[model samples]
Target chain A: MPQPVIAAVGSSPVGRTDFPGRDLFSLALEEAFEGLPDPAELADAVYVGNQSEQYEHQIMHGTLLAEWAGLRNVPAERVEGCAAAGALALRHAAKDVRNGEHEGVLACGVEKMTAGGTGGATDALSAAFDRAIEQRSGVTAPSQYALLAQRYLHETDATEEDLAEIAVKNHRNAAKNPRAQFSDEIDTDTVLESPPVAPPLKLYDCAPVGDGAAVALVTTAAVADELGVPWVTVAGTGTAANNIAVAERNMTEIEGAAVAAESAYEEAGLEPEDVDVAEVHDAFTVSEALLSEAAGFAPTGYGYQSYLPPESREAGWTDVSLSPSGGLKARGHPIGATGILQAIEAYEQLTGVAGDRAVPGAETALLLNEGGVADAVTVAHVLTAGTEVAR
Target chain B: MSGEDRLDVDSPLTLPGFFSALADGDLLAGVCADCGEVLLPPRPACYGCGSRNVDVEPQPKTGEIYSYTAVHTPPPALEDDAPYTIAVVELDSGGRLTGRVDANYDAVGIGDPVELGTRALTDEERSLALEHELEWPLHVFEPV
Candidate 1:
């Protein structure tokens, strides 16, 4: 079977801004479709990810975004698993193309979190937890992650400086990304001194709440070949779920991410050593440390040491560059927009369009996305240049 | 309760009203009738067997801290009560619950055995409003 290829990608400039009650999903859909090479073109199917209907106060957002994007006649479906919504949408689009159900598909992710204010938004996101056991007990997102960070610190030799290094590196990378929410170059001291949202996890250590959207145009290799457009083939896709309660799993490890990454690597017929660039979810500083180990980029409980010194970017150990797109920590996590944005970053790096932040001579890229305190779900995918799927 | 005491009441409730009835002196969770899986926080369906046939029954409140964290800055509503410890207590019945740690900052650690204690009522309006009650009751966990 022919693999699905990403043909073109688009996104709204991610940052704090005013939309004046404009439906966020609608704005993102319009932004994605406008100024494309072919405006009137329609997709065979569409997939979207949304978390809280009560927060957005809009139900059936899949149809809303589809209609707003002029894809009113296509089949559209919505998938939700907290932050993984966007990645799950892409997985659906990939499945449709892989199954020959659609010649081409559109996967879009958008979230309007600023609508309800920060406290309300936090409450809504917290609903992803076990309502009866966790959230009902008042364990918010930061607190849940803080527990993981605490355990990680206790088990490993990693320190607050190690996590600050990740924030520094990603922030430097975001400085070159025009759409990132925090593009300023920050040092370790700044991150260390930032107000503590959760102990050992400072304000700078967490991804900000922002409103934005991202979209990707995917098609079968045959369709891309006929269109004469550049593309990246989806070589592998994997997903896994853990216990909804964070306390149920090992706080020092992200077992689900490890499972997902191994599956993706196997499906792609590639090893961790073969990846040239990666964009792992860094929803929080500790998340990057845990995910890097789980994804096999570093030894278990030692990923905090993987932070390549800024000077080392020119000569980093293990040539595979990571998070050249600033990642969630610096790139502004607009929730639903995150997964698609990761794909966009991967596409840019693979195509050498990432400007100064581009990983030199990049060809293969991996993306890891997780949702809800590392408890709900995780998805990973490997992408290779051209029409040839990795094998 | 004094004004300060009311302010201290902004913590989260350890269990739902139904389960609160259990912690109030009874212990209860929905047990899967089909697979016999015990569900905490009491769900209507059995996650183990995907069966809706379940029975709410009393269970042991004894558990251990699977993991924990000492929160220095509480949520905005609980700001007055900054610097508290919260932990995930793994029940002997194979369930997990999160609540305030009964240990001081230097005393708590992961994997420590814990048992359920009485809930502390808070007066914070938002916290009270969330429980839809006049007071917010926070579950206390002690080292077993």
Candidate 2:
């Protein structure tokens, strides 16, 4: 059976501004056809990833998006799971190609968060949480993550400085990314001096709210060969979910990431050590550290050590070059589009299109996308260079 | 009449029941009769045993803090309570619940002992939640 490969990818610049009076459907349509050679030729199916219908007071996005994108009369549906909506859509698209259900599929993720102000957006996002319990206390993403950060720091040797280091590194990397929301260089002092949104987590520690869409054209390896286009094979995919309420699960660890990554590594017949480049969810500074440890790149209580000095790295910490595309921290998390954005980075890095920040000679790249606090849902994928996969 | 008399079992397996029980000064845990898996903020079904036969069990009011955060920027509902503390309380029943902690942000720490307490919701909030069948009783944990 031929493997599924992402043949083309397109993404709108991630930022807070609305896309020139267009809504999510138009954004999805524009990005969907941007990378394709012929905008009129549509895929066999369309999968739209959308997080909140409450944000736009609109539903049936998949049907609407496909119609607007000229993919009429095909299998189209919306896939959602909070922030991991994009990754889940791609996962479903890969399944379609693998099952011989479709020769090609268009997977797009879009969210128009700016339609609702910050409070309204926060309320919509909180709907993904345990509404009866967690949200009742008015807890939002930053607050839950803040609790996780506090617990992680208490249980480990990590410090607030370690958290700040992640923000600093991500911002520095974002400076090289033309599509990032915040490309300006920031130091530890900048992060430390930032206003505290939640204690132990300053404003800089959180991913900025923004609106954008990302689309990937996934087809079989045979189709890519026919088109003679650059591609990356989907070697492995895994997803896992935990308790929605942060308190119901272990805050010191992201078990979902570990579980998902293990499954993906097993499916790919590769270990964490074999990954040449990686993009893990960094919605918050604490998340990068927790995910690093959970994904097997770093050891327990040492996830933060990867961002620390060399002395820390020497102690059982073989760090992987993380988030070359600036991650959600610097790239801006537009909810539904976040996961697909990570996949885009994997495609770019594997195809040698990632400028300045590209990992040299990268062959295998891992993309990790997560939803909710402490990883209520996590999706992991291993993408190999098309050349290696063709064999 | 006592608060207990007003409490009805009509929705014991639902969130409103959880709040109703809290208002009556009891912490309820939905114990799966098939698997004995306990769920806090009670649910209608057992995720483990795939059974709807859940037994409503009352948990002790005391628990330990598993994790906590001090919110400096709160949602609109909690705007006035900015800089307030919330914790993931690990109940004696082994179930976890996130509730507000009535303590200074600097004073509370992980693993600290806490007891469940209820706060009456504002009239507007209570009426809205009641009309929508939402839980209005605020369950908070205070340092023991």
Candidate whose DockQ is highest: 2
| Tens digit of per-residue lDDT, candidate 1, span A1-391 | 6698887777776766675212555555555455454423637678887666745687676777777666666788778988988888888888888888987788888777777777766777778777545654566778888888887887888899989999898998999987688879998899899987767688888888888778888887676667665688888999999878776576788989989989989999998878888888898888888887888777677777657743343222355677888999888888877899999898877766788888777788989989999746998999988743222
Listed in order, the DockQ scores are 0.29, 0.61
- Provide the RMSD of all predictions against the true structure, rounded to 1 decimal: 7.1, 3.9
Give the Cα lDDT of each candidate.
0.76, 0.81
Question: How many angstroms is residue A362 displaced in model 1 relative to the true structure, after the best TM-score fit?
Answer: 1.4
Give the winner by TM-score: 2
Lowest lDDT 10-residue stretch of candidate 1 chain A: A309-318
How would the docking of model 2 be graded?
medium
**Residue A341 of model 1: what lDDT?**
91
lDDT of 1 by residue, B1-144 (tens): 336422122211124445446446766677888998877656666767888777767778788776676666444566566567788777889877778877775687777888886665566534524545333344578787
